[model samples]
Target: MNELFDQFDEFEDDLWGPIADDAMEPVADLSVGSAYQAPVEWNGIFTSPSEENNAYLPDVEPMDQTDLSSIQSLDSGELQPENMAESFFIEYPVFDPENADLEQIVGDPAQDMENWHMQSTQSSCALVSQEFILDKVLGRDVTEEELTSVATDAGWYTPGGGTPMNEMGRILEHFECQVDYDINCTMDDLSAKLEQGESILVALDSDEIWNTGADLDDILSEYFGMPGQDANHAVQVIGIDYSDQGSPKVILNDPGSPDGSGVMIPADKFMDAWEDSNHFMVSSGASQVSDQMIGNYYDRYGTWYYDDGTPERYNWDTGYY
Candidate 1:
């Protein structure tokens, strides 16, 4: 039995050795690009606990205008509220520097402006496109060898390694998915295109509408048709499958998970999920079409919600158009 096992081991190594060596040998055509930038350190402004007292509204008044005897009695209980007269206690919100109301303060406004600057400068840096991912699936007949060559030439990945979904955001550098807020096409049109085999970019403003009525699980099931996808997660639509299921299923490159993995979703509900997201896109070719298809209404903009009975208008330039 030992002799037979030893023979099998020798056969296995002999079979795979040349293949491994061939893969490792560098070709004249292969070129490796620089790595995507390492993540930047966060510099978001944070208000210290020490700043709490700065928020206080003092009740003191102008010093010289007050009566001398009243001032002398200030330290004792004999100075009743009525006797001292009422001093106004003004309250103001601590605001970001861009929105600070320093001019409203009675004294030299420089001190208030300085505090606002400090807080605003401490704000943390974040990946601008951290909300979406991008991937290009290899079509049939493209071997691992051919695909690697193309991906390298296109400046997409490392030679011997894989690029992460989150890292794509950093490499793209300033991930403005669209030029502005508007989407290019109608939901129906986008649906038809996605039904075809085109790669699409779906942007999600997780801070807004989609996160409203649903928990992470509900939202994931609704969007990807996978029940466990979380609210904190953002992914791109790479492929859609409809071979066996009643509805089409979307293939997504989910970044939050390990391996920057993929997931499939039921196809029919895809548009419903896209609309639930505040802003998104489906790139038909090398060019982006949000400007041509959906219009710029959502161009770099967000959405708002109110009570069900609140009056609303369908402004074409804003969304309905």
Candidate 2:
């Protein structure tokens, strides 16, 4: 038996000796343009996927925010909300540095986002996202372990495997929040819902969204420039930062990051990563837990109880737009 196993091992090494590396090299470096811009320390939390999955990335059209003529404004000829184009998504405004309120965020980072939870496993982004949302909006003290057990029992998630892209809605519904899924969602759609103080969860490319740095754009210029497929990660959308008028950022509570609370990202880069999933989103009503001891929202057990109600409204004054 030992001699047979040894022979098999020798055959395996000879068959793939040139391809296999004892050190295991990264076949390609996606950040060719700005290797100096993105710090190496962030690579652990912000993964740089191998180029093998490049086939999955799609060509993303440029996002145009220049035309705001259709947007509602304080004007006589302003378009009514109902009259707006379905394609006329409410634009996410760029941050205006001169605004005193915008400058306040430099001191109060917690205004847009306050809390977060990191995933225990690399594949637990979905579950960890669930846990973080439930904890913040519902005040639910549920643990990630508990969420894993419940999600696994329902077959919504595999033990160590990633939750299916379509299964996120089921898990949210199971947790008592109303979920609306969009396979072809856009940033404008997000802006519209967020303005109403709703909770949003998005699945995008962790590497692309994380980029070289949290705020830096991808160094790769090609469509399949970066390695790996999109939608490999999920995060809770808290708000959009329009303080940097030229570079409006998407504020998110990314569960995959070590300290992901209130992570801000450039909108264009966000669109690039999001295009990977066709901008898949699961938008839901925020927790409605009131002062009353019990409320309408149910727990994981499905018992009728009380809890959080509608989420925080998008505040334009504080970069929450």
Candidate 3:
């Protein structure tokens, strides 16, 4: 048996030697533009989950006068509520950032504004949130790959990698789902949705939310060329707890975190962070229109239509008018 196996091995090596040598040989004078290069790191600000062993609360001092003023402007109602629910939560899969690798995924990082690390976390939040809504809420067993492909096609995974508030809604609509892009919303609004078994994706200032020490103002100025400051991090709101008396707390499936577990934040603190981006959130619902039907509508009417349902314009390159 050994002699027979040795003979087979010798035959295989003799037949494949030349092919292997040619494949291993380096190309001569490869042009820099043509050379395959790894994806570049994103220059935008990012918020990573804190690794410190301390409790969820940051080490910073209690809300000062300025902080309280900011929180008050964002949250109008009194902190203490008369009839608050015990607690509410949504069941959803969590995606962690630490596991992302650029080499494994294929997308245009420059157009998406997503570095490899940001793509893993940000895309995970959108993909997992959509999956939960589809499978649990809408009774559709959609796979992760399918959802990722949808996001990639929608330009959600482009250069910057994170989906904008408006783009988030459009992406959900592409799946024949309805989405509400709520801006300047309050905790009560978020809590009410969760109580109704709905999940929300929220944008937050990384520095305020995770204490990442990121200068959001500078980062936005440099990366987006925008003058005003905005939230730099995105997460999904899954649960809420009122057990802390006047200080209600929110439970989030933060992808920026290590384990993608529920990270609780004080309501006031959350409001402070969320207000940076006008408390932007995306709430999705099962659409009455089927996916195929919507596709057909677009195919006929084109992508851009007037309020009267007439085609406003057409792009020949995309085959959409």
Best by lDDT: 2
For residues 149-208, what per-residue lDDT tens digits would candidate 1 score against the true structure?
Answer: 223333453432343333333322221332222354454444454545333446443233
- Whole-model Cα lDDT per candidate? 0.31, 0.58, 0.49
> Where does model 2 exceed 4 Å of error?
1-112, 211-226, 287-321
* Residue-level error in angstroms, candidate 1, position 203: 3.4
Alpha-carbon error at 256 in model 3, in Å?
Answer: 2.6
TM-score of each: 0.27, 0.53, 0.47
lDDT of 3 by residue, 41-66 (tens): 23221122222212222232212122
**CA deviation > 4 Å runs, candidate 1:** 1-198, 204-233, 268-272, 282-284, 287-321
Q: Candidate 2: lDDT of 195? A: 72
TM-score of 3: 0.47
Top TM-score: which candidate number? 2
lDDT of 2 at 227: 53
What's the candidate order when arranged by decreasing TM-score?
2, 3, 1
The residue ranges of model 3 lying beyond 4 angstroms of the native Cα positions read: 1-124, 212-231, 287-321
